[model samples]
Target: MFIRNESFYSFRRQYPIITILVAIHLILFVWMNFLPFGNYIRALGIGYNLAVANGEYWRLITPIFMHIGAGHVLFNSFSLVIFGPALERMLGKFKFILVYLITGIIANIATFYLGGLAYPPHLGASGAIFGLLGMYVYLVINRKDLIDRMNSQLVMTIIIIGLVMTFVNPNINILAHLFGLIAGAALAPLFLIGAKPYYAEQRVFVDHGEPVFDPNRWQKKRRNNKRLKQAFWIGLGILVLFGLLSRVL
Candidate 1:
C-alpha cells in the first residue's frame, strides 16, 4: 500500500538487480525443498564454518541464498521487496549489486571467523538485508536534505527493530548482521553518489515516460554513471580474489 504506482510499475525496469536477487533466492529455496535434488543443493550452498576453514570459501557467498526454513526465506524476501528496489533506483543496478555482494560476503566471513562454530552452519540473507538497511540508514544520515526526514526516522526505527531481532533469534548470527551493517556504512561513500546528476541534486523527473533521477544538475561532475560500473567490477574482483585466497591459504 505504501509503494507508489510509478515505483511499482518501474520496479522491474529500474531495479533489475533486485528482481534477479529475489528470483534467485526463491528458485533456490524452492529447488532445495521441493525438488529431488533438494538435499544436494542444500549441501552445496549452506555455510559451514569448518567447511570454510577447510578452504570451501564459496561458502562465504553461497549462504546468502541458503535458508533454514520457510520462515527464514519469507522474512528475507519480504525485507528485500521493501528495501531493495529503492536502493537500486538510487545507486543504479550495477552499483547496488556490488554493495549487496560485498557486504553479504563480508558478513558471511565475519560469521565464519567469529560465529563460534555453532550448529546449523548459519545461513540466509539476513546479513545482506541488513546491509541494504544499513545503506538506507547511511543515506538518511548523510543526505538528510535529499530524503524525507520522516522516512529516515521510520527507517531508523526499523533498523533498531531488525537489530533487536538479530539478538532475539538465538539461531541467527548477530555477528553477520553487525559486520554487514558496518561494511555497508564504510562502503557508502563509494556508492552514495548517484550515477546520474539528479542523484547528486536529489531530484527526480520523467524520462521517456519513466521517472529517473534529475538529469538537470547542470554540473558535469554530477553525472558519473561509470563510478557505479567501475566500482561493481572492482569490488567483484576483490571478492573473487579473497575467495580464492581463502581456498588456497
Candidate 2:
C-alpha cells in the first residue's frame, strides 16, 4: 500500500526533533565548505596528513557536518529525511535525540582511537546514520511478524546499499561505521525493550484525536533521571581513573 502524503506529513510534524537535526546538518554542510581550510581538512578526513597537523582536532566532529559535495549532502540528507522521522517517532524525541548525539560522538571517538590520532582527519555523519540503520535493522528483526506482510525486502535492499556505499565511497570511514553500528545495536534494546506501554499510549492519542495517556513522556523522564544519576558517578569514576592512569603510566 502506498503511504499517503498526509500521513507522511503527519509523521514529519510529529517528529520535529528529526526535522531540526536534518536542517542543522544541511546548514552546516554548506557553511563548513566555505570556511578556511575546510576542503583541505575534509580531504584529510579521507586520509591526508598535512591537513590534520594544523590543529584541526575539531575536524573529527566537524567532518560529521561537512560533506564532500552536493551529491554527498543530498544522499545523506535524503536518508535522514526518510529514516530519521520514523525512528524518532518510535523512540520518542528525547531518546531518539540521545541515541543520535551519543552514538555520533562515540563513533567519532572510536574512529580517532582505533584509526590512531595520527591517521588523518575524518568527517561525515555517516557513522551516526549507520548507527540509525543498525538500530532499524534490530527493530525490524525483532518485530518480524509486524513487517512480514509488507515489503520487508526493502530492508534487505537498504542494507546491501549501505554495504556497497561503504566500499565504493573513498571518503567513508568504514571503521567508524562498524563501531557506530555496534553501539546503536547495543543501545536500541535498552530503549526498545520497555516501549510497549508508550506505544499503547501513543495509539490511544492517535485514535482518539486527543491527549490521553502519556506513558512515553513519563517513561522518558524516569529513564533520564536514572541515566543522570549513572552519568554523575560514571564521570567521577572516569576522572579518577584517568588521573591514576596519568600518574602511573
Candidate 3:
C-alpha cells in the first residue's frame, strides 16, 4: 500500500508562525512610513535616544520587524518567503520563531554595541533573513544530496549578489548582516542535532506500523528523547548572558 505524502499546502497549514511573522513585518513596514521623520525611523519608528532612554528596550527585538523603505521591506520579505516556510516546516513553529527572534536580537545588540553607541538608528528584518540564509547554507553544506539537488552554484550566485548589494547600498547595516549570519551558522548545529533523534524515531514508528506521534505533542518521551528542551534552555541562557555582557561590558 502506498501512503500519500502530504502536500506543501498541508505543510504550510501546520506552520502558521512564519505567516504571522511575515504579516507583522509588513504591518511594521507600513507603520514606519506613516510616522514623522519616518524615513529614518527604526524600532517603532521612534528616535534612537528616545528608544534608549525611555527604556523601550524591546525596541531591539521590535526593530527586526521594521523596515526603512519599500526596497528594504521587499528584499527582506522576499528572502523570508523563500526560506521561512521550509525552516518552519523542519523546526516546527515554536522553534523557528525562537531562532528568528533570538538571532535578530543578537545581531542588533552586536550592531548597537560594537558599531558604536551613537550609530544612526537602524531598522529591518534583514538580520533575521540573513540568519535564515546562513542556516540554509549550513544545512546544504551538511547534506550533500540536498546541495546537489538545489545547485550550489545558485547559492553562490545569491551570496555574491548579497555581497554586492552590501557594498553598493550605503544605508545597509553590513555589521548586523555579518553578525546575524555568524550567529545563525553557529546555532544551526543545535537545531539540526535536536531534530535528528526525533526524525529517526518517527521513521522507526512509521516503519513498525506504530501510531505516529504528533509533532507538536508535548510528551516526556519526545522532550527527553531528543534533549530539545535542554538545548533550548541552554541556548536561551547563553543568549541572555551574552545580552547582559554586551550591555555591561
lDDT of each: 0.71, 0.61, 0.63
Model 2, position 58: C-alpha lDDT score: 57
Judged by lDDT relative to the true structure, which candidate is superior, 1 or 3?
1
Q: Against the true structure, what is every candidate's RMSD?
A: 11.9, 15.1, 13.2
| Models sorted by TM-score, best on top | 1, 3, 2
Backbone N/Cα/C clashes per model? 1, 2, 0
lDDT of 1 at 234: 48
Winner by lDDT: 1
Off by over 4 Å in 3: 1-14, 34-55, 145-151, 194-249
TM-score for candidate 3? 0.66
Estimate, for each residue in 1-249, the C-alpha lDDT of model 1 and write its tens digit.
113234655766766787778888889989998999899989987888888888899989999878757666766776787667667767777788999999999999888877756635777888887888787777777876445544565567667766765665456678889999988888887798743322343345565665566545555333333443453444345334433432333
State the number of backbone clashes in model 2.
2
In Å, residue 221's CA in model 3 sits off its true spot by: 38
State residue 7's C-alpha deviation in candidate 2, in Å.
8.5
**Candidate 3 lowest-lDDT run of ten:** 195-204
Q: For model 2, give the RMSD to the true fold.
A: 15.1
